[model samples]
Target: MSSSTSSSEPTAAWARFLRLLLLFAAVPAAIAYAFIALVDPWGMLPLSLPLRRETVTTNQRFSYPMIAQDPRFDSVVVGTSTSRLLRPAQLDELFGARFANLSMNSGTAWEQAQLLALFTRRHPAPRVVMVGLDKEWCESGPLRRLTPRPFPEWMYGGNPWRGYGEILNPFAAEEAGKQALAMLRLARPRYGRDGYADFLPNDARYDAARAAQSLVPPPAAPAAADPAFEFPQHALLAERLAALPAVTRAVLFFVPYHVSLQPRPGTLDEQRMEACRAAITRIAKARPGTALADFMIPSPITREDTHYWDPQHYRIGIAERLARGLAAAAEGHPSAEGDYVLLVPPVGH
Candidate 1:
């Protein structure tokens, strides 16, 4: 009896210790899970507790779907970081429609397609769908669907159940805490609700020396390309634009890159670029309520070093000018300021 008692006591003690260990582990895990579910850091959970949400993270691939699917916004601006500065409020006024800027930093063409898919899925007849074409659209190879930054494919638009597992992570828990702080007014929003953010490092002034440092000299002449060279990404773009309703005004503009980045005249680079532009122009012409603008040339905006924050990004004044140009381009009117040229004028022009 004594031997049995000793053995059984240890066994019971071991079981109790294991139970305590599990209890400690599960308690915190449960709390964290509840916190994430309630706060909905990504602002996607259907059961998310009532809270005023703002974009609290710079991971735009994850943060932008909120802007894409926002009910208040009936239109979306989809592109890479170059398009982020196109303020939604200005576009709203210019286009006479509610707008959301869903541009992502370093967003690949495929990623932009996914964003467009999400917006269109929610809004079948958006007033406008502005695609600020980037290099990815003209890139030669198969379109790279994503950038180096992590993109949550599940969060974009998919079976809702797929994301719960993905979002239940330590990173999401941390975001939840930050989101809670934002709700409490202790933290500030990183990007605006409509996904506008002046991400450039504010300068006291645009120093010519500083601008020159960021600008690279034009590239040396490149070897001739094979005649069969093609732009396959344009097809992807065509597919997306074709999905839009006829009533939806689709404005496709080559994002105005700095002159230094533009290809030299009549080189293989220009050959491929002009071909891509021609392809996009054809797609615009074939579709109603669609227009195309070419802003990739050596315009006053593109040639001025002071106008660009970098070869890929422009300052606020330039962004405004581009926005105005887009408004006119949508109506088949060429840029009055000569910042862009209309390739496919609007319908009825």
Candidate 2:
């Protein structure tokens, strides 16, 4: 009876061990199937479907095409959407230099520096890199952290998977398979263009004209003026400017803002603006080949409600005038002075 009992105990132990093995094996297989079914073929699973407003378009259908197609650009524009008004074609015509606009919406100084590094790696360091300075870019935060995924360097350069493992986890063999699938076009490229260009009045006016509607609206009320805003991010801006290769000529321009929408008196906004201007002034004085151009003057054209897409983006005519002003400021630099004047608009329009 004792022998029979011992034999039964051994059989029971074997059964339990087999059950545990099957459980472990089955769990992974189930997860794998689910991942295969739900994850996009690119090894990227949408954090949220129906892409949000902030998603950086990763596919080559839009701005990637612009970068890939233009390999000979001798100049590049780096800024947020505020600088997007300055078109590459316009700058190329004015400066006689091949150019590309590397501007993105809400792009932080860190991202801009990274892009500059990327550009220097591939192309000849641009002869002139016009950086647009706006008040909001000084705000603290990783500008793209709230989006579905961190901004991928692949959006600007090739190698989508370059820094993937560092930014994401759950690195698995299945993910490798998925990436292979994406390469073969079996999976959709996991990004779409948010209408960054849509904010420009040029496209708005075109759409309005096509729809047989007038684009102009009535004049807007005067914007409250804030004279006290202090900008702390200018230090970061200075660091970035200093790090640029000696071959690159950098120009920082404070883009115009509609006076009608200016901040109120004694507000933090005014203080911040003052700090930024002061910081930029100091930077220009210290840097050998750097210059500043301030174009934030209120004019009849700029004060009109229709002149801007919102409070910051200007119409095509205004953008053209500003670009020409920038060209003039850049050209006016003397060969020996190592200093350039900041050009402000003439009084009263």
Candidate 3:
């Protein structure tokens, strides 16, 4: 009986230790997860504590979907980093609708299409749907149309419960703390509540020498045209635009690539790009309120090295100019400046 009692005591002690271990580990973990869930930095949780959530995270793939679904924004700016410079407030002023620039850095055609579909479904009678046309739209043949940054497809669903657990990670916790701190004005916001951010380097930090290096293109003789060249993603763009309500004015523009990066006038490169543009123009033509602003040509915007930060992204002043130009194009104003061609004019015009 004594031996049995002694053995049973050890078993009970071991069980107690196990319980303590679990308590120490589980309690803190649960608290951490609860903190993250309640703060809901991504705004993907139902338990979100109604924090005035400005974008606190740099991962736009995770942050911007909430902005896309925001009812305050009836219109959305969709594109890659090329479109990030377009300010939503300015766009709202220009287009007379609330705007959210939901452009993702290196955002693929697939991601853009998905997010756009999400926005059109969430909003009612969206005013102006502007898409910054990128080279990826002309991407031909067997493209998976994905980028290295993981788009949170899980967040776009109707059920918030499915995505709540995803925010329990350390990164999400850190962002949650930042989100809280942002509320207190202790942490700086990465993006505006309307999803606009000046992600480019400050004008004070402008390094022309370094900028020059990024502008230089590799040795390029015009490419030989393949009979198989196709703009597969144009169909995807059309489908997303189709999903928008008939009243939504769609503006599609080819983002200005640097002249060196743009195709030579008579080259096969030019042939392929123009072919893609023609198809895109046709898509825009079918939709009455849609307009196509063609900026992917060798003009002042593309040729002037001082105007651009790199081959793809332009300076802030230039971005604002483009915004105003887009507004003008939307109003059916002809490009008298010879900068861009308004391919498919707006409906009333």
Task: Put down candidate 3 lDDT per residue, 203-269, tens digits, no spaces.
Answer: 8888888888888764645657564477778788888877777788889999988887887765766
Show where candidate 1 strays beyond 4 Å: 1-9, 218-221, 225-227
What's the lDDT for candidate 2?
0.56
Is 1 or 3 the stronger prediction by TM-score? 1
What Cα-based lDDT does every candidate model obtain? 0.85, 0.56, 0.84
State which candidate, 1 or 2, has the greater TM-score. 1
Candidate 1 local lDDT, 151-177, one digit each (tens): 888877667567678777888988888
Per-residue lDDT, model 1, residue 115, is: 85
lDDT of 3: 0.84
Q: So what's the TM-score on candidate 2? A: 0.59
* Residue 306 lDDT (model 3): 83
| TM-score for each candidate, following the candidate numbering | 0.94, 0.59, 0.92
Cα RMSD, model 2:
9.4
Q: Write the per-residue lDDT of candidate 2 for residues 1-349, one digit (tens) a residue.
A: 9999999998999999999999999998766655443442332333312221222233212233335224567777777778876867778888778776766666666566556555555664667778887755545333432223256554445554443332233443345344445555676433322112434434544442333223233243343454433444556567766766676666777777666545444555555555666667777666666667765544554455555556667677777777777777676542132122374321111
